[model samples]
Target: MHPLRLLVVTLLIVTVNLLFPGAAHASPAVQYTNPIAAQRADPHIFRHTDGYFYFTATAPEYDRIVLRRATTIQGLATAPETVIWRRHASGEMGAHIWAPEIHFINGKWYVYFAAGRADDVWRIRMYVLESSSANPLTGAWTERGRITTPWDTFSLDATTFAVNGVRYLLWAQQEPGIATNSNLYIARMGANPWTITGATTRLTVPALAWETRGYKVAEGPSVLQRNGRLFLTYSASATDANYCLGLLTAAATANPLQAGSWTKSPNPVFATNATTSQYGPGHNSFTVSEDGQSDLLVYHDRSYRDISGDPLNDPNRRTRVQKVYYRADGTPDFGIPIPDGLTPARLISYDTPGAAVRHWDFRARLETNVTPLADSQFRLVAGLSGSGTVSLESTNYPGYYLRHRNHEAWVQQRDGTTLFNADASFIRRTGLTGSGTISLESANFPGYFLRHRAGQVWVEQNDGSATFRNNASFTLE
Candidate 1:
């Protein structure tokens, strides 16, 4: 291989060894379901060092700033929520309460949100609320006034992160001279969490064809640090189905204040995955799995496409979470927004690294680059037969599940029979092959294990050979 190619391959191998299989088991990722929270747009999930995933978002009513906390990502779905603050009756913080994000800064909790005047609902501006108590829900909050920018234009969706001990704020704003509805900007902080210092740097605008649909917009900024680079993501277009995500990348070593350091991707990264029936997926925040190893994408979208009247008047946009994978080059491969019902994953075999367990034409086997994509994906749901077992339900097939009939693995629809439940269930255990993988044992046939032979899947008795371990062991993706 070329020298550079060799280096890239080495890095990829190291990353795969470090991030997958082992990190996969740290969280019960399958327990999650889509639409984690309903009528919550511009959602933000912050995994604080307190071992809690703090959540806040734009309420469908556009009225109050609310918060929820849970130890695990899925727990947030039903965790008790508290209204930390509400909109004022008049003046600056009176109307259009939107996109609230909670952050722990300088031993205190701070919330950044956008608000408008009661009389002028569209006159939105970024505002702050501070709490000295560690538990933000029960703590008393004080209004910290507005985050004043160079020019007093419409600004919202404020997010902040610290790199090299320097804290910087990234937000969406309408510049006085700019023709676009909004542009992304970044600036270092002065003394407190609510203030910005120095000249602001414009990072991205609505220049692409897709970004200009419905509205000339570039907003909802979020940043993820990985692969020795800063990946800044922003939402664009109107709030309707046209809204999508765009990315801006810059080297970690460069001066971020210099506009030349960042490069904007010509196309959107994650958008409305029609195959998944998820529409207008945008305004995302990044958080890690409970293990602090696997990165997770947090965002919101509607289950349906069309709206009755104004899209903003519709309240179905809901919060969702999914795993984030990386390419060999170390960039994030967001893939697509998964379909609703339950969280989906691909069972990747250890031996066939390029392929995953997929069902094609009702035949369960390993395949690479499967089309419709959903054919290769499945949900690991609670066993239909009993507790302490798992059933792999086909992502696209829905009611159908991967089952063993005459020891052969196949995707078959449930007939509502006791035998069908047992045939579809399997007990997950430590890899029969080795570490960084999992083994599924037949729930009905005690000694039988799901393995691959000649690229075909089968539930067979383990012979205690290295080949059996290699064939039976698979990693959750």
Candidate 2:
């Protein structure tokens, strides 16, 4: 009974049986929102105008150059990463670098990329990389070489646009008597950054039929400009479900600098619907969060399918996200293709409510509803299961329950800030009364409720209680 206390009680019973093995096992709620960014892949998000949101991806062991920065997008999966650039030994900065976007332009900070020769990943071309700082997390990038353009066969993704003040760039080449596998080109940019001035065009090819799936690949282009028009969405075939997403346009009045005047889109404005495990969702990039309302849709999927039987050697791809809609004639609609556990469309905070303040946001689904894998932390979704204390917005914090069966999910943040817990689970008790009343919904109208009757309020339910709307006001801090 004393061999170092029996080796510390046999290593605390083998660390509680390797962290609780058969205690009827109930320790699984720790998902900020579901696999936010693990294994990176072709992700590319950028909010930066100084407010932060930088994501970048495709480093899959190309030897470094990660980046994360978050103020929100759910704090970019626990942000705080930075690996700028790496792997350079001789000349064109050494070997196979791929993807790498990051733009800010005209005032500094550019990043367009694609590398080659580590025994050639097809001699991937294109480059750019600069930084004049405004806080690219403390600036100083400098590496503006090789942009040349015009042809030179096997090119890479590259993107950029400016219009009216001129500045083009769009890429994806192989024009010399093409054999397939590369098309999307464009030109413009020249004021240094390795020149280009003009003559490139070619625009779209893979020639519809879902752009020739799995290899006649058109290549990621991405450029938008609504109202007066100029879209250009690109990326097709070869990535998986034959990879997808296509659309092209031009007609702010004509001369879309010729490619025979834009206008493609015989189909494929985004695809993949193998019931919804989401195969090759294409390389996309478009933003609008930070409360500007919505419009996300980052891209990259494949939760399960062949995985290794090919989808280009599926690493389960990862990075899938949603939210992007608009159609009546304004074009750009992205519907029907959800199903990966569906629940990512509640980002509407307007800084208004008060009276005792209670806020709610949910989309976290599962039951085969899909949308659950987007993690950052604080997850406990089960209809809201957990301990007691069920209420908030009573004048500040009295009796604000959400105790979550004891694991934790208590919130109090300010105004005497004290109830801070995280791993929650309650699944029941959401009330306002009888058959229904546990409200705090928004899309602006219908069924909204925040009724606390003193110091913090937002009520809009009707059929009872003075038809409340108290003209906006909410604060519980």
Candidate 3:
């Protein structure tokens, strides 16, 4: 072979490797930190096909409907909100605008919200606005008039979803003959989302002790369909600390209009967590992560247990979001309302595939095929010493940091210990394969990188091999 030809071939190989390293590997799993927006309630986020997440929530004042959109979930926190519509100055929709949900249907945008009259704040009724613009934030939203019910009574929290080629509307309302303040109801939606075509059927009433706590309520209904079933979740009890989420399940093939077809969970599927200090967690909507890989639960909760005035007027029910998992039986597991802060994320091992970095009894180890929660999650925080490095703080252990002692990783309290300063900090670098994966190189030990060896974490120098690169690389999800 000619030397010139061999040299040309070598140069081409190097250039290709440099330009697209690790391109053969699958893309990393997407992860997001939560509390996407603060002080916003009845959160609704939907990922559109145009690769953006559109978010809308009840404003603290409950006086207007606002909309925001971002390419990423974390970006929604800083996205500028646009006031698309405001309450009427008088008559119906004059005050108390709540639980506004935006949906794109039939090449147009429709917003479903509940409003009440200025004179009678408790006379809440459902209303909608329509916009022909592609971008809901920039278009005109014309009122479509009030959605009148059979009986003049209280109703709110209207949500719409389609199954088996039919669209249905689910909401909570007060039946004239029913003693409870509100009960869950559903009906087939007409061509206009604001109106229902058929008779409304009572699905579930607030009859359980938990549901009847402060107020006999079953409002704020949201829908999630999976595993051949439709899961309808609603907020129950008062809007105070006792507020929680209740679930109603029905087979996807069954008639949703039939009240007996749905089975209500005997207990609240999601509720307040005293350990996390999150109270009154309810009124949740679901969306997929930016990469369209994971399901996310978007909801509102009070950071503190106590509120000074009426819970509805407290204005502290901030909007939060977290990843939602599923049970073995194909049921959605909301887990618990995570505490306010950076939500937990996992470190996926590149070499071992499904393995992840997990802590057992304060010692970091590689756990194979384990669920990424609690011990497996770590808050990737900025380095303590302003070095542009990163520190891994345990989600479950709180103040503990992942520190290397004698080249092995261990979770230890910060406490200003000498070892915690540089040992716990790492400089994040591109994976050896040059993929989106990350390699945490020890800030103190320079060439040494964090890697799992024999199911244990160790700081070791790179051996410049594919095996070594795979061992040292981790997907920061």
Clashes of each: 0, 48, 0
Assess every candidate by TM-score: 0.84, 0.31, 0.83
Return the candidate ranking by lDDT, descending.
Answer: 1, 3, 2
Best by TM-score: 1
How much does each candidate deviate from the true structure in C-alpha RMSD?
6.9, 20.7, 4.9
Rank by TM-score, highest first.
1, 3, 2
RMSD of 2: 20.7
lDDT of 3: 0.84
Model 3 regions lying over 4 Å from their true place: 1-34, 49-52, 149-151, 176-179, 207-212, 226-229, 258-269, 274-277, 326-331, 339-341, 368-372, 385-388, 406-408, 432-436, 446-448, 453-471
lDDT of 2 by residue, 109-150 (tens): 787778875555567788878888787756778787677776
TM-score: which is higher, 1 or 2? 1
Candidate 2 stretches with Cα past 4 Å from truth are 1-35, 44-59, 63-94, 100-115, 119-123, 126-155, 158-169, 172-221, 224-228, 231-254, 258-295, 299-412, 415-438, 441-448, 451-466, 469-477
1-477 per-residue lDDT for model 3 (tens digits): 799999997886576446534332434444555567878999999888878899999998999999999998899999999999988888899999999998888888889999999889889999889999988999998899877777778988888999999998888899988899899889999878888887888899899998998899999999888889999999999998899999999999999999889999999988887766889999989888877667788999988888887888888788888876555578887767766677766787866655679888778899854443556767788875446899988765677888888998988889886557788999989987565678999898989999988999888888887667778888765
Candidate 1 C-alpha lDDT tens digits along 364-397 = 9887655545677789989989999999998767
Off by over 4 Å in 1: 1-30, 351-355, 358-376, 382-389, 396-430, 434-437, 441-448, 453-461
Q: What 10-residue stretch in candidate 1 is worst by lDDT?
A: 22-31
